[model samples]
Target chain A: MSDRSLSELGEQGLLPLLQAFCPAEQRGDDAAILTPPAGQQLVVSSDVLVEGIHFSEATTPPAAIGWRAAAANLSDLAAMGATPAGITLALALPSDRRLSWLQQIYQGLDRCLKQYDCPLIGGDLSRSPTATLAVTALGWVNPNRVIRRSTAQVGDWIMATGTHGLSRLGLGHLLGEWTLAEPLRDQAIAAHQAPKPRLDVVPLLARSQPAGTVWRVAGMDSSDGLADAVLQICRASQVGAVIEALPLPATTSFDRDRLIQAALYGGEDFELVLCLSPDWAQALLELLGEQAQVIGQITEKPVVQLRLSDRTEILSLDRGFQHFTTH
Target chain B: MSDRSLSELGEQGLLPLLQAFCPAEQRGDDAAILTPPAGQQLVVSSDVLVEGIHFSEATTPPAAIGWRAAAANLSDLAAMGATPAGITLALALPSDRRLSWLQQIYQGLDRCLKQYDCPLIGGDLSRSPTATLAVTALGWVNPNRVIRRSTAQVGDWIMATGTHGLSRLGLGHLLGEWTLAEPLRDQAIAAHQAPKPRLDVVPLLARSQPAGTVWRVAGMDSSDGLADAVLQICRASQVGAVIEALPLPATTSFDRDRLIQAALYGGEDFELVLCLSPDWAQALLELLGEQAQVIGQITEKPVVQLRLSDRTEILSLDRGFQHFTTH
Candidate 1:
């Protein structure tokens, strides 16, 4: 196919190309027609990824940019323990960009959409000085089984799903600050580009406990780093936390301090940091296998204390990424 | 209060302020949980407006910026004949913009959300090189009653709800290309900044017809100019149109040619253009009072022809504001 500017494709010409990427169930005119199955509540969340802020063109390909944006929003639904249904993307691109670039981006987007079984329903396109993508992913969950960040109790065990700090490691490799050979470097880069949401575990997590028992699991996606996410749960639930001195999952080969720093302060990991009742911890661990790890425990005191591996120091760390403060 | 940057407010610091503006029904963790009432299908649409593309910072205020973005998306729901349920805003702004300015934007957003009974459910905020807003509005409609752009039939009366060229006139006034005194200028400017979505008319339009009767009504919001909207409907329906030189609702005080050109070519009007059955047209006209007018009719041939007022000339025009082209 010949290269064409998005302006050349125009809005009218672009619709078919976009629609081709969508599943047949959601190709409506103005809005997608969705019927949430009976006994389910619709769950909706939105996230925007700007060109310079979220991904720099110098280090990222267009397709990966799209995949990363989709992953971020899908992860929000994953945190709620909801099944992904559909997503709408609103994109702004500089007119100078070729339509081929958009197609490649959509290819990445389609990879995630297909993996999650979420269709692209509708979107709007506009001109911008820099490329920006805003995506809204909709999902469904039983009304009674929804998870919230504010429900972690003082005695709950903190568990993280999937490897933490991998994305940050990938960034290091991309920037040439560090180097890893073959498969390891590729794994790091893939982790950064297409971090999968733990949608498979949501159903298991949302499964009801015994009839009279109080439900135990509460969590959110660790997009803002593990430390920040734990702090958020504490702030919302009016509790505190104590991070155990255990080695983090998937950090054996890396420098200890750097990986720990990335696990604590680096953002965009897209893993779930969950608080579960101590009784259910073993069951969750068995269910998640090597993907889950017990990182810490909730505390009664209103402070976050990290228990050092050296066995003597219990230091209070407040170094998680905060949007306004760091910028 | 001191002037605080968005970074200063931070995502966490701004949540309470943002929550203060949202309706009570939709404040939740992770994603808003919405239960669509029985028998209604959930409808969703998203639109993004970027700085310098949709509106420049020089002439438009921050509040208007927020309001316009919401209006545009809400209008999409209106076109779908959906009752507004909720909206999620994804915002990206330079760190230097004041929190107060952001607050004002929310104020404008609040105005529309409250007016339509659509709550602000959730949002994401991040730093960007340019100020940009992307809004996703959700609504509901009877599954069988969705009015699609492709459903327009030949011999349908092409009806337009509300004024056509007012927003373009407003733009001219903003650029100081023309002068209007007092309320006329203000009215034009309001049309540009806060083009109200026809939420009130959607229910009336979606009213089901008698059993076994063919319901001949199809519509879409006219955002990309009237001419462009007509072309979209024609292309989708594989039909033709004949626009009559009838007097538009708000063009009495303007020069004929300029107003006509604006009506046909300028965009961001947010008005609904419907193809109605001849019998239903009169009833809709009566119901809508001064806000509705029959501008043309859908034709058998696949061409858009404009009939001149003097009855001596017929013209085919394809001028409309398209992205990437004019920019």
Candidate 2:
């Protein structure tokens, strides 16, 4: 309840508060026990968010930081077409960080987990100069239904869930690099801070497939922007892609060129970029309504080419977010 | 191989190098897929190590850092009587760190994983001011045989795997707090730098149990020191304990009092403290030979007492290593 620093609380004092976030029976054990669902394989992924690299305390709230960190791993599961099982957090915080701040972070993490039916099973805590959160998420999927990024066929259509650029624009607004009207500005900020993972779309994707027919769907989350996601899929699948259009969100404040760049190179979108056969794509589009759109198509050229109205250009892989490099 | 910084290699350039540490088929996917062994429940744990807090770059090498970080999580799995399935790493390093350093770290991590037959399945990388490693380990155990810390019955004999105080002494030598002779000094240093998890003793404990007999053994790793481990088991099981002796290693350099203090309060031993019936304890001692020893016995009184030839004293839980507090 008090805004005491972690140094004051100590590891012994902080553990009980953390235990409250996990199931009572699973707490006080060396490790949490889990049983995989019958007829399902386990899906696991880990993601790290550093204080300065992933989020800034100046612009991001503690709760949003927790929500965004958890969302990143959940998005990975969604990309694999897996249902959320549980997540473990290994957190390192500065000794001077307030106990209230940590509680809020856990609250936000709990909200996101509850939304996706993922439980906080276990975690480890430590002290550091810079706060760091490494989250490992677990999910389950039928062996036959698991999607991958390396199986895109030459004729498959590239589809994406939700429009891009909104998250980037939100970041721009937060950094004072751009401006937008009331509702749009708020929407952009929310998208940048708490981007939702597309786990809801996973079941819908299964429904889009024709009953009794086998289809291969290759997909990944667009956390590093649409351009990088498409490039990765192309490289892995040994196929190329022709981008007919960018999935830009409706925003009048930015020019077409800027919007295109934001949609292409801006990072942390958390949308799903998927490739499937034309029949499946059409069925998915009808079922998803306006929630999804066809942005491109796969080709055999082994290069990502943007086929705009008046010009064609190859999208470079080096342009998106790279950990240590200046963008 | 060049000693260029990670900024020079970039994320795309670094992927292949990091990928080499993981299984070839599991690399480049949204999430790694795993099938738990038939009829076994999955056990999961996470552990984080931070520079300055857990280790210093001046005294610790990159590979040892990686190995120790992995060992910490593996130790948790061992405490749960689980056989490791796989491990995932989420590492954050400063951009200025050389590629060779990261590679060596991975080499150390690979060595530890290979030793335990635990494959590296997945990981995430990021840039940060301070170096940090968060490892999540997965293992499998039978539901009926899972060891818990809260199951110690009254009158159970307390036992420990391996000699204590060596790791703490090794840490002291590393920090220039103490001096020792040739073989012992090297042994102490190695213990501090690369403490092995007592996973090998898990099956031996099972062998010690009589065939077709159900045993409720309570156990946990003594990473936080033997005294703290005993206190935790006592609190969790609502039982007390009497420490009859300190499982001190052979050393003439320190007096009995100093050795006892080191064994009780010095941390990061990675040994197991267990409570079982006297019959099982005797069988385990015969099977383990010099690898394990009986140290105490569980009591009905709700307190931990240390008994010696001179007098008896109550052990304090606050004496052990705690994060955010100076020892």
Candidate 3:
């Protein structure tokens, strides 16, 4: 028993070890008691990352896995224009030596938590044949400031925050299929490993919600892919979209078509695709500078049309990350 | 694509089908907005149930699986005496036809949620090699009304709500090693499949805490078995306890030793182990009647003594449902 594994700790012995990692205020009792601030709606969302399905042990380090898992859930909060308050994690791991792996993962979580001011409320640790991470992040926002995927109005500009296609290129680098020079490789790898959630953009979008602002924001994270996300926004909002061939956001050695393909179909980008009025779009771009890029426009028809530099075409929009379905 | 599997529905296609089951107030947005009522502290907890590890297709049905999964988290809320508000589930499954399986699970969740007024708020669906269900339940409690597992005091009466050992006996029947007749078998199976959380007891305990009352309640659910749960409370509260060989509840044909073992070590009872002043124990007993039973007394020493009719022994307290550790 003295030399027992985490399995031996059996949640009992494991609690003390893990409790040190959680914020002090969130420890004890079966559940944490949160004093949600007045006038703010508590926004909650959960995301799970299963090993082999979401990441490869061969390529992704433990810390990156932890960082990415937390980031994925945080991205959900960002999509809603919510400021993260806390997160509860449910971790399933394989072995005791994985304790070190978990510690690294906690380091990753701590970095994200500290940067975003979200505390690690509490979590459950269990053993599994394969590793899985589930994160439920709680955030706060004015009820009127909530952004939804189902409210993109006709004639609204479709905009994306930050760049797209970097994570795809990063995946390529991880797979040893593409070679990039110097900082580009590091940047690409970072994008894939620890993509930043657009928490900073929430306040800017929130600013547009006071009294009688003309801007209406409808959005979600572009995790599956750009085209698929556009299709989802259109389907949810009961509108269509016309996506122009936007310039590729990452420095890549791939040809134009490959870069375009990555931008349209490469998943794990973690960028926000938003719909807003054109005037607000201009105002947002001026505020966010180059971080906000207008990529398309919402239309009344329920179709997704991709306009290339030299050709106009409608895409089937069938390729995005769907669980159980193999690409 | 029309004939595509859940993997093809990817999270996007599957959302609408599952969305219909969740409350309309909790749908649409990336994150659900919850307005925590004034003067109440938000209480939240999460639990995970993995297939094969926690249940098997040979023994448990999908609805039971769903029911048990939600029940497990709700039990945590019940342990804290919190009234459930909403729940967010993250489900990982294997196939497309399992949509029916999922619907059954949702039916189970709906049954529990409806009974407690806890709405199905939001969730994430993903594909997995094996099925996994993670539920995060949110509730609310008066800040002063919160109970803890670590506050048991010396000379306090150790009590239990509801019966013991039925779930374990039911598990035995489920494994085909045992059999029960008629209503008892059904009751035992229900105990295993959908053991009720003691939400009804919270108000009773809260009723005791109105200024200068001698009663102080310290409690937690006995999901891990009586001995293990006792040991846990004893350790956290830094007190010992003397558990009597109490009369077993539920009609069973098992011999005395077997019945005694089941009562002492059977896990998943979902009953609560509480500590309170002796006088309040009588008050609570009068209030709850047979639902509340005095099983032991907290002692000053740091040891657990189990007293039989003619013999007394120290308990090793090794048995419990521990994750990762094999039975």
Candidate 3 lDDT, B235-260, residue by residue in tens: 87999999984537656466667666
TM-score of 1: 0.94
**What is the Cα-based lDDT of residue B299 in candidate 3?**
97
Kindly report which residue stretches of model 1 are placed more than 4 angstroms away from their true locations once superposed: A181-183, A206-214, A245-253, A311-318, B24-28, B206-216, B247-252, B311-318
Alpha-carbon DockQ of candidate 1: 0.74
Q: Could you give the interface RMSD of each candidate, to one decimal?
A: 1.5, 0.7, 2.0
Give RMSD to native, each candidate: 2.4, 1.2, 2.7
Model 2 Cα displacement at A112 (Å)? 0.7
Q: What is candidate 3's DockQ?
A: 0.64
Tell me how far the alpha carbon of residue B73 in candidate 1 is from the true structure, in angstroms, after superposition: 1.1
- Model 3 has a clash total of 5
Considering TM-score, which of the candidate structures 1 and 3 is the better prediction for this target?
1
lDDT (10s digit) by residue, model 1, range B182-267: 66688789988888988877766745243456655688988887887787788778999999854353535668778777777776
DockQ of each: 0.74, 0.89, 0.64
- lDDT string for model 3 (A18-80, tens) is 888787767767788788888888889988788888888666888888788888888889888
Residue pair clashes in candidate 2: none
